[model samples]
Target: MKRRDCLKAGLTLPLLPLVQKAAAATGPRPAAGLTRVRPGAAGWPGTSDWDQLSRAVGGRLSVPVSPFLGDAATRSEALAQLRNPFFIGDQPALTQTSGYHGAWLSRPSARVVSAANSADVAAAVNFARRHRLRLVVKGGGHSYHGTSCAPDSLLVWTRAMNQVELHDAFVAQGAAAGTAAQPAVSVGAGAMWIDAYNAVTTHGGRYVQGGGCTSVGVTGLVTGGGFGSFSKAFGTAAASLIEAEVVTADGRVRVVNADQEPDLFWALKGGCAGSFGVVTRMTLRTHALPDTFGGVSLKVRADSDESWHALVVETLRFCRDTLCNPHWGEQLRFGDERTLGVSMVFQGLSQDAAAAAWGPFVAWLAARPQYTLLDPLQALALPARHMWDADFFRRHAPHLIAEDTRPDAPRMRMLWKGDQSQVGWYLHGYASAWMPSGLLDDAQREAAATAICAAAAHMPVELHCNKGLFGAPADALAASRATATHPAVLDAFALALIGNAGGPAYAGSGGTVDEADAREGAARVQRAYQQLRTLLPAAPTYVSECDYFQRDWQQSFWGPNYPRLLAAKRRYDPEGLFVIHHGVGSEDWSADGFERRR
Candidate 1:
């Protein structure tokens, strides 16, 4: 079945055996007290109004005419789904069935128009403005807060706009028109990192600092100030953003770049997605294929506090060196109560050079009696793609890719992939996406270790790190100077340290995850990370991966740029045509779980 069809099938999927009643319970409830979730009726903008949206698009318009969802019932429907079987079913989330949506957070917009080109997007925007209907665009819908989806809104799905091209002879502005500009690639809004990488490699370079995962859309990642463990050697991929084709809220299609609409161009780099406008295509710089060799995955169990302490101390030392190496592209996933693993790869080096660089870290880990190294992709003489089965898993956390061959491909978790055994809360889509700015200093690291030990006592403590992803301040500063991304990006010691809360699934007969569970899980993780977030030198949060619950999220995510971004929003989207929680100027509006009230 098509991805959207599979996702649509998820809607009527039988409620988990446990949450059959209370989970899907309708009507007003205490948890929803703060914001009322009223069901939709056939009163406003009925079928004829929706038919107009179809006329406005160059693609399909998925309109659920049922009164329960067509108008505003999605307010409650969205809230309820975020709780139970919706998020923790056979699939932990509304998995990315299509390019535009990495998360199944979308509800019945007035209609879901699958825009095939820029004109369709322009038409949809004009229609939304004329009717004053809420307009939401789904660009690789991978938001942690699920901001891409909204109730009683017009959802423009850009998933069908998947096309890629290479500009081998193009020259950038500022330089003499004839000066040799770097080779660049143009990806459609629906293109993913894997797709971009695959296309680029076929032409030349095997690497493109697109995103951490394979399925993550290029449009969302690049626009949100992306970071890749593999790209640490190449700096942020967004730094390569040379141009974009955007359909602004004013219903005008303009090309934004360093020379044109410079302000909007600057903001689009890291101001997060869906704020300024909807991009149809993006142009990013690509590097020549580097000669990388020697990749390995090593792991040891921390079954005891003493073992855990040793692992923590060793981690501090390894990072001290790893963080300093700009050319060392490695992946490390640690913090689970009983395990500490490191996946190291040396790019732009020979086997001997690679060994020399990581030999100490490897030997030190091996000599430790407390460590039990598990070697899977320990191929010592191949690049990541040649060594790993899935190209997406290669740049991302390859250690998690099953050590043993499986009969079927791994199930996708939002934009990434995970083994079937872990297709639960730990997956990308199942868990909340947060990028905090905090370092585990001598004093802080110890405390964090203690907290981590407790948090991961039972389940794996999911974490991600690489030589360049939040390795230190210098890396972030370099990335920031290139765009208006969050200042926290510079301050954060790690790209992300997901708070260890909630569970894989609530298997009880009628006690599956609920709205309260979601709120609590979010709060619990926030409190856990707060201890370190408060100590950071600056507030840094990833825009592509966002959560509204953060303290001063706007300031934390955009830093000083938030003011400028707000101004830009006011200028381009004055009517609040673009509204997303935690997005620029979102503070001007309030939500009652339904339409945006002026």
Candidate 2:
């Protein structure tokens, strides 16, 4: 039988013995309360209830067991697996990021629904709602704010739902009769950006805007205002969305788009994941491929504070004039050690053109005797279709990619070497702010440069150029404006990120967490962000990558769009069935999302 047919068949079976016993004990409906029930609590579902659910979902439900619960040798193997994001994703109890100090720690759910299709997801959502259980949704398990994992919860794990398909000509569900069909790709919620890139770009010879890190989940990234290495050219992943299949709190399977349930559709586009519903699949518009994709990398150190300030000012001027367009993206780092780092990517430019664009800046650094070249500048370009081709990288530039070493792993299962550090990182502190485009103006450029240098005195600060739409094409900006992301991004030149992390320190994983150093690093990171905020006070931040404990998250993450998002949340999930840290309507619940505010 087909999976969907099996789901229908399973739901019709007689109630299991345990479920019947539990139904008799608790009556027909769940008890009314302001708090959710945890394990061993009154009104909690019985074994029979879970068994019935498992049967309904084709026996996909299972109790999650932490790898740390195993014997010494088993634990060692688990620790080794932490370095591989694919391995971490495959484990129900693990997340790409282990935890954040004093905020949230990655913990396994009481049970997990390893969903294989939308029917499985609907079953899990219905079960959680009926039982009044704390529900958690995890796709790639890469939530930096720990939104993907929670203790004493029922997890809808979508990792096994990965499936990618291409569409040559697609139209919205209820478009006008003459609406033109557009090229697009329909991606499973559980699929990572790499999976989409491989299908849409590497194989299909097209482009779909997505996260810079290949391992980021497609649904999670889009729902949180996704940005990629080429966002300056294509806009956000959310903006590229054409349609989404979502399962709301009431278990109604909904296909939402611009012409149907438009509010919910808008909310799904950059509204914040796990707020409105669980997305099973999404169709995103694809663009024509550029001829080449390229990158530039270099490092320089200044001998004195004066030189460092000069370096920062000059670099800002260069970015404002030359690199602010659609061709440029990625980051430029300013470090505490009086160092400047260039780690940027480009699209539609040849090797010589890209190199020539940076010629003046390179000459300026070389002319200064106090500036020493720490890493020689390198500018390179390649066929755009080969950008995400794992085989191409492995054969030519092995150092640029890290492959999954498991003998059975797919050959395409690889991540950028630079992203390997984040596989199981434990966050000490992290914060981000949008730097207004005005900062690049001649009159204010010095102030912006000064703020950067001052912030770096405490910790490194990275300016992600593509996160802001200052120099993007008009259509890209208009599309972003139609989404739920903060309007501040429309006028910003870059998003400044200041943060630090330690190695994997998951509890009981045999990895020691340095409390003192973590505390100190957290303090420094906070101070660095504060220094930048002094220049651009009340600047908004990206919801996917922002301060975990932000006091005014509503304003900082969505600005004026929060009210609209909250209304959509009430319309679709009035009972507050879905919740995540700082997500829409989250203020109505406690920190752990277990207790109602009233």
Candidate 3:
């Protein structure tokens, strides 16, 4: 075959264009370095030889996948297509299950599947089912553990299945004074939270959910319990769900809602990472539109460690006690310095009311006279409107301080390993213990804070808890556990590591030493987390992206619902299809932790 054809067949290494062009521009070569494999036409595992897999899936999927198979320029063209087919130059390098927040390297068995619509997803699911394949569901590719993409599994990518349908009745309708259900919109599982937000606003409606980052996928956030600034005004992204269309393991599609499939509906809402099924679409009750007033409030600096610590504690205390009780939105963010910032929002209200609601904290900041505080609302300027005011401060602080002087700041990768529970004061108890730890001395603390500040100066850490959205009905969250699934629910803390892009590379470092250091760092983090675990009203589990291989993960994410989930799995995915890599029905897990029938 021609070199371009070989490229189309999944030779992803960046090659010299001249060599490929000369070969393809001229004629086919007898042999090239490329290993030809064709598992399936769509590039799923277990279908064909690697060499011929591209043509098979390309032919089947019926998209311009060949562009991905060709030479440098041709493959680049194909990748571009994959990014955003609706918009030009949006396709990204679709690595099978890689590119998670903190994932540095992925195992070699990685593969990719791109779905253009729900039909394609059905086909993908069927393919995996027939082949008895282990699958990973990819929506936005942002999970820290990269759960959507797995190392040793067939990846069912859903990024291409983007669609949104809004409902006017749901937005306008209210809970009947006596008994009534609100109207809701139907959204494709692949849609981003921002898309839903825009749709709700455009339709003259509003949605109350916690979606910290606009780019986060609605499916993952909603199903996993989304938290955001608007959460206080609303409830949780999960709470707004009126219904959802999910694809079960048996390749059967079903609509789950409170009144429809009560158990499954209950499981779908905060049931843990993914126990019930692969959600293809969601029906969400939309609220009335409200004018949102929010921005970043600033004035904390790097040099003042004591002042910074006080501010962070005060802010957290204020939100947990003062703000959460009043149903107001507020978030406190601290960077690697003496810097303190806040992102507060008031839905459907004017700036004055918001100012008054935030009066106590504002007054405290002003009276302290320790640092300069700016009006976050006023500091926000146009032309750079993409960012909120709080984010702007995070980015600018780096330039203010000389990079060389910020040595103590450890510019390391950031990975988030967090969980939610009925316990509202989890952080309150944990923070007290962590502050005095010898992790950072006075000077080191200052330097580290500076480093964090510098990094925030680029991409600010989004404090999404402005909504005080945690502590859903403990009984409801607990009810998800029906059996002993691999990952249990209570222990399931959705974890993601936000690694710094283009940060540290251990190129020349001794391999053993670097590995040991990483292990040490990981251990330190684990220890600290264990300390925090003490505060859990109960021993809530910590779910890591890397924990996919563990059999316990199912039980951890699913909690008490594991048994019923397995029965449903037997009924739906008897052959074990449509499983999430690190999820309940995943085939990668050994049968060690499953509850046996007596």
Best by lDDT: 2
Residue 261, candidate 2: alpha-carbon lDDT: 94
What are the models' TM-scores?
A: 0.73, 0.94, 0.60
Q: What TM-score would you give candidate 1 relative to the actual structure?
A: 0.73
The Cα error of candidate 3 at residue 115, in Å, is 3.7
Note the clash tally of each candidate: 7, 0, 75
Superior by TM-score: candidate 1 or candidate 3: 1
Local accuracy of candidate 1 as per-residue lDDT tens digits, 1-598: 0011000000011222322232233222222212212226433456676677677663367753322222356434433333222132212113232111122232444466778999999988887777656777776555545566566667777776778888776564443456666678888987766567667763355556666455556887888777765544566667668888899988999888877778888888877658788999998877667665345555677557888766765675566555435555444455444777655555566767655666776777667777666552243554544322354454655654432122352332232223122222321222222323233456555655564555444333344444124443364357546687755444334444443322333121122344465555555555545443433323355655434455556655665566666656767776666777767756546641244433
TM-score of 3: 0.60
Candidate 3 displacement at residue 594 in angstroms:
16
List candidate 1 segments past 4 Å from native.
1-43, 46-49, 64-106, 172-180, 329-331, 344-346, 350-356, 365-463, 467-480, 491-493, 499-527, 531-539, 546-548, 592-598
Estimate, for each residue in 298-379, the C-alpha lDDT of model 2 and write its tens digit.
Answer: 8999999999999999989998999889999988889868998888899999999999999999999889899999998888
- How large is the C-alpha RMSD of every model relative to the true structure? 11.3, 9.6, 15.9
TM-score of 2: 0.94
Compare the candidates by TM-score and give the number of the best one. 2
